[model samples]
Target: MLRAQRAARPTAVRIDGIVKSFGGACAADGISFEIERGTIHALLGGNGSGKSTTIKILAGVYQADAGAIEVAGVRHDARTFSPRQAWDAGLRFVHQQQTTFADLTIAENLAIGHRFETSAGGRVRWRAQHRRAQQVLDQFGIDADPRDELAHCGIATQTMVAIARALQGVEQGDERVLVLDEPTAPLPPGEVRLLLAALRRFSRDGQTILYVTHRLGEVVEIADQATVLRDGSVVGRLDEGEIDHDRLVELIMGKRVQAVLSQHTRARRGDVLLECDDVVGGPVRGASLSVSAGEVVAVAGLLGSGRSSLLRLVAGDLRREAGAIRLAGQPVDFSGPRHATDAGVAYSPEDRLASAAFLDLSVRDNIGIASVGDYFRRGILNHRAERRDARRLLSEFWVKAASTEVPLSTMSGGNQQKALLVRWLRLHPRLLLLDEPTQGVDVGARAEIWQLVRNAVDAGAAALVVLSDFEELVEVCDRVVVLSAGRTVAELDCDGLSDGVLEHAVLSAERAAA
Candidate 1:
């Protein structure tokens, strides 16, 4: 009974001949797809493969220049419907990057999509709205008090608020269409599975999900049908039975040799370059570790794992409640990121917009932000030296852009990440602290970034890398430190290690919840 009776079900969405472009580059070209009622249809592709563009158009963020969108068989001009209209038509989109009023309470965030009207007496119905929101939160296994402020919660909880807001229109009589874009990337394994199960529960209730993700294994696991896009065109749409990871990769890349990526190897021996002496922080407890030069050391665990907090403490972005950090066998006092930098440490923060780049500033300024000392003459920025310095790293890192003078935000997401990396790499630090370095980068660029990290380590600088992709840990890291709920549970050495062993160690290292 739980089989694909799509032919018997009503058609939820029908897209035809959607075409869009930017800067003369094709993003979505004559793309066509159909979503059946009560199905989780996945849009899978590389960063620039047009998947995001198609999703953006569906979400009313972008308009299709030459296409038609039909929701519940009602034809749309694609460009005419405003965002509010899309919502009115039962389209709820959850962006991968969670957006919320950080200062607002959880209850306030849940009531965001409520349709309010003034009563005759001008009375408010806030109580009824909060109760309705309570039912929604209960469905997601969230038992926290609604009065809790959103920013005070963990990233996963904040993401859940976004999920609940997107589901607000489900009780309406219209066809329920939900679009979730990479909602699990920021989550750890346990939370990721929990969210995936929630999605499956939603699917069972006749909700149509247009899910977009880069994790191929997840697509194969959860998608009712997989749609592959390459260079802005629909290359393949595979039903559940016909899709596998290899074929999926080939479909996105338009060729073979991708088969080798799964079986690749570049492991080598290196010397220890950094050691943490019972490193202690608010979230990280008694975390002792040693990382070698020319080695990629990874911190692996579930979402609330002390991974990011550990890196932040080491880089001096957080207050060290106790313990210490050593670089090249020398005791270091990292009072702040500046102190860390002065000690030849380069850290790429997690939130790029807030911590990494001056978004509105020129790429030249963002790239030269960290080590502006070299391009400054007695506190005054030397424009000529800054241009030369920015250009040198821009080319070295293979950042694709018109010129160094262009604004950092104007560049693609991958390029911005590259610029951030360049900003730190120029420092030639003894240690590199990369927190989700390639979070939103494209696959091709992801490989390049990996190479850049490896090249830095190979150059004799110790590296501590934090990645969402567990496979990336096995691929590039020589040693992995497993953190569980803000504690170091195990240290898995990569010497003669297989992917299976690394994964098991990471999973098994979890301490019993206290």
Candidate 2:
């Protein structure tokens, strides 16, 4: 009953020593792996570890400089392979970033995946498409209204929608390969559970899944096998029975490493740094909270508890149906994010890689993006000043990179996040908003980022940090705000903040509200 001996079904994909280089630098270095039919295989790596390169090659975005890719035993000429070919041959990739139309309904996004409707008729008849979409969505336990905009929903729900869209091709018994690149990055724990369970059920239905993710915990919980990558090379493969968290970490970093969760000293006494009064958004009740200067304020809440949405309201990223914000006792109205910026607010968005990076730009340019006002003058270029400052930030933030001039997209995700931190910190803003600040960031990088946040607070900046990782909030924040269904329910100081207490409060508050 060994895997290789069972009736000899063709593999979903076989990546054979694929290599890719950009600008004379090796992006993927001789990587190889095989994903079998109807199995959930994970590609585990930190950012810049060639995960992106390998997936891109499989998706036909890159022509590998060496090696070959085989889909269902059919070898692809790396130089000639294209995404259209991959799709025509029954492979689909759902990116971490939003690929669906923002203004379009969920049904429309799914309609694009309905292979049978490739009519030459110049019009897309969506009535039939919705029915088709519903049939597929029904299989995955998605019951959301199809008329809702894909972008309007939270990242977790949209991700489910994305999965639903991708599976349209698979449910037809086309021998499809579904590659999900960090699909759970934006999901809360509950949604994550749903996704994992759904994926497991899908595998039973005979779909081959190649999942790429950074969260090691998720790998342990769901993946049957994991392939580790580092600096464009395949370091090792952990079969279903072989991988554990510690072993996986060792392989992922390409060296033995320790998990260093950040712990910090709280700022006990401080002046009022930021305050919001009577803030209102849909599903968010009249909410009010404050963060002190020289201190970190943590916002903890259950899924759909309005933690992220509240932070979004305060940061000017999301519109407030109504509210008043005060910074240093001055009245302010946030017309939008730029208005918040003018008021000296810098926010690191929850979705770091998708929202924060300039993919085609160099590391220097991305880090230097927020500092342009101070660095540039009279519309004249200052190359030396920019390079000098960029290099300084990279060193200070401990951003791992081959060189500062390297393309931002080529760096590991943790490094990309570090660059974002440097970019925001360079502004020296009065109040900082960090949503899931260290998400997808490694243990070492996470610790360093915490220290950096402390340094910022020590320099007298107030911060409102929203994180789903309860441990992170406990370590860094001076005050805790627990929200339930878009309203601030309970506010606790550091004295009573433990995982159990916080969890209870958030849970109780949610239950009572419900």
Candidate 3:
């Protein structure tokens, strides 16, 4: 039966012995894999493991040093392949970054590469273009007006528009491949489900998909096959029958990683470091929680369940509508993040690129930007002192970079996150607010991040984290405060918490309200 299925579907993408290098460093070292036609294949690996390099080779962003690529029975030399060649071969890509022009209307964005009807004198047929764009949007079940600006729509809608535009000219029976690189990275959990459902519908219609993500749960849910990459090599491949959470992690990490969070007993919980009394702001409604000094507390909930909102409220990133916050027995209302920071509070938001990291600046600049006053003397900027401080912080945080002066964009997501954390950790804030601290990070970096959080607590700093991964909550947190629909539901100690128990508590809360 398996042989029959293989023979029937044929191969959509075949990458043979692809080798790509940059300045004596091998990004993809003789890697190879085949994505079957009409199936969703997951590309899994850690940062610096060559997942992006291989995808770039496929999308024509990087020319392979040596290898051959075959798409839909048409072979192309890796050395000569370009992005245009890949596109002409029916390979489409929707990368993690937004590709649509935010200022342009949906119809105009769709008509980017291929414009609408034009008159002999060179006038664009606006009405016809809008109608055609609407037809495509309706076909994909995307609810948006073609005449509306793309910026007005949500990220999920913009993603669907990008995908629809990619598939505009291709026919149903054509052997087309769509590579979605972390498409759901910017979306909420509810939006993620919607995108996955759309991918399933596409697969049912015989469209091939290459799904790249750090979320293993998503892989198990949507992928028909998975190719695990480690150190620029194909470690293993699992068919639908072999894919599971533990097995996939083992393949990616090359070991049986303990599935649960680390079990460590701290000395003891200290005094109440931070407190929220009936806080209501953003999506949070009458929520209450507290973090004791030297303790790591996690806020647990589903998306839109007020987990992040609660953190933002405490961080002063969002304005509180009612209720009060107290720090060490003193009631306080912060005017903004700066006021909070001055009051011994630090926050790391989930969207690192947008909210946290300075992508255009150097690693040293990003690290030392927060504490520049420390190096200042007589109001004169001290470059030498700043560099010294940055070097020390980089070494302390174990941030992997070519040099401290290198652009923050040169580092991987994990290293960038470490830099951001180090920037705040250096402040020795009394309270730390981390929202999805390890959202897009890999396993190794995750261990390092947890260790850093624990180190902060050890130094008498309290931590209140918001994490979507329940296992992580079980591992690093001493206690978890469960929120349901913007209200604090239950507080469970992590000392004896199991994954099943934590999941049940959250789900039961969700269902109870439903």
Candidate 4:
């Protein structure tokens, strides 16, 4: 009877007055929302908007301070919900970093999360496991051999395997809800369409999904219901017809903002500040582009098309095998990043927590560590001057934090990115190399970060950025350079560039290469 009741319920999940706080900061303040069964519901918000906190609570990663959640018509205390309970309640999660082993076979990857079929004699049943894996793959429209290694599959296939593993055993009338947090962040444009199609198929077959992403276009295309959260509270809820780019942005930002990057106006281009000719390094083969002072050029391409490798070669992080680089009309070859830094070139990598930021260090230290010599006097470090500059730059960059003395990890992802930018922008580099500068950041911080880049470019610094978000690339860039299979395939002016135009340029390059 209880199973029948759960199957009959229209709503899949419900949150009532969910509240979570950390160190006196309320992350989620009495947030309440409902997700109907067999629908794609998007939980939209900016960085530090409490949507993450709410998801963490639902996943049992963090116990809420107060509230309750109803899963399949069964109410449970939020504070005592464990991960085991979530799994038992038919809740599954596929995070941005999927927990699949690249070296394992597809069948092995599938069996890792669930149990493997075994005989009473304690022997493994490989055939049964392979058969079940093949069934799941076929069910999700994944075309791959179950016995093949997952590493041999494309990124889209790997992601589908991850999703299939997550949705294992979650069938019709199961009242299951799959939570996908930025699943498409690591995927390229072509792969994103493949994943979204699979998701829509699941929804059509009675699967409920809670999709969290910063990409508004995907939300518009896939979401059936939209719940916007701001500063830990429910701001607005939009039905399918109500979800559009402008309306969603207005609700997420709590203002009638025209667009996320609507405020950007192109800056005047000066003389060519940095030039690359036939650059060949790592995966970048014959990649070439030029950036002028006060100009922003963006690299757009599919994954492994050498977008990042090109940036690394230009930034002196990778060895240029066969290419000539000219900075200010002077031929230059940098041996390392220090050489680049000394030569007025600043580069910020994509991974902040791993490469850029010192999580254990204070914000002041993280910003000042790169240029500690500026604070030196009488053969001793001057802490006072460093603190002063840190505070000034924090304010200048619009990094919101309690104080400059707090640990860098205490701040949000967006602030961490801004803080890193503050470090580079303070150096006054003649050319800035930014690879996915706004990759993980939310829309609000994304705007602020681009604004900062523009300020630097306006101050005579040339910027070459690699952005996967084509909309942002179209908005913030002065020119678009398309790369394919380690080659510069096309270059388009951003004067009238649309997302379709940019994507078509990239796709056309890939298709031609194929």
- TM-scores for every candidate against the unseen true structure: 0.86, 0.83, 0.82, 0.95
RMSD of each: 3.6, 4.4, 4.3, 3.5
**Each model's backbone clash number:** 2, 3, 1, 0
**What order do candidates take by TM-score, descending?**
4, 1, 2, 3
lDDT of 3 by residue, 88-143 (tens): 99999998887889999999999994677777888998889889888888888899
Model 2, stretches more than 4 Å misplaced?
A: 1-10, 101-108, 115-131, 144-157, 169-174, 281-285, 301-324, 328-344, 350-362, 369-383, 402-410, 439-444, 458-460, 470-478, 492-511
Report the alpha-carbon TM-score of model 1 versus the true structure: 0.86
Model 1: CA > 4 A from native = 1-9, 21-26, 100-107, 115-131, 137-161, 169-173, 257-270, 375-392, 495-510
For candidate 4, write residues 1-514 as lDDT tens digits.
0011123228889999999999998999999999999888999998889988999899989999999999988999999988989988988998888799999999999999787889999887999989999888888899999999999898889988988888887656888799999988877778898899888888878899999999998998988889999999999998877788888888888877644455567768899999999999899989888999999999889988999888888878898999899999999888877889999999998776788889999999998877999888989999888888888989888999889999998888889899988888999999999989988777788888988898889889999998988877888899989999999999999988798888888988999999
Clashing pairs in 1: 188-303, 272-292
- Pick by lDDT: 2 or 3, better one: 3
Best by lDDT: 4
- What is candidate 2's lDDT per residue for 121-207, written digit by digit as tens? 756666666677777768777867777787777667787788778766454556878899888866756667778888887776778
Of candidate 4, the 10-residue stretch with the lowest lDDT total is 1-10
| Candidate 4 RMSD computed on C-alpha atoms after optimal superposition onto the true structure | 3.5
Which of the predicted structures, 2 or 4, would earn the higher lDDT when compared with the native?
Answer: 4
Cα displacement (Å) at residue 18, model 2? 0.6
lDDT of 1 by residue, 1-514 (tens): 1344355467899888999987776778999989888888988877667887888788778988889889997889876656876887788888876777889877778766564333678764667656766777887667666778898877777777887777764664459688888888787655676677777777877778898887777787778888888878899999878878888878877775343233435445466678887788877887888887777788887666688888899888888888878787887768888888888888888897787689888988888777677766777878887788678778899887779987887676777888888888887888999999878665666777877877787788888888767766676677788887677778776656775676666667664544
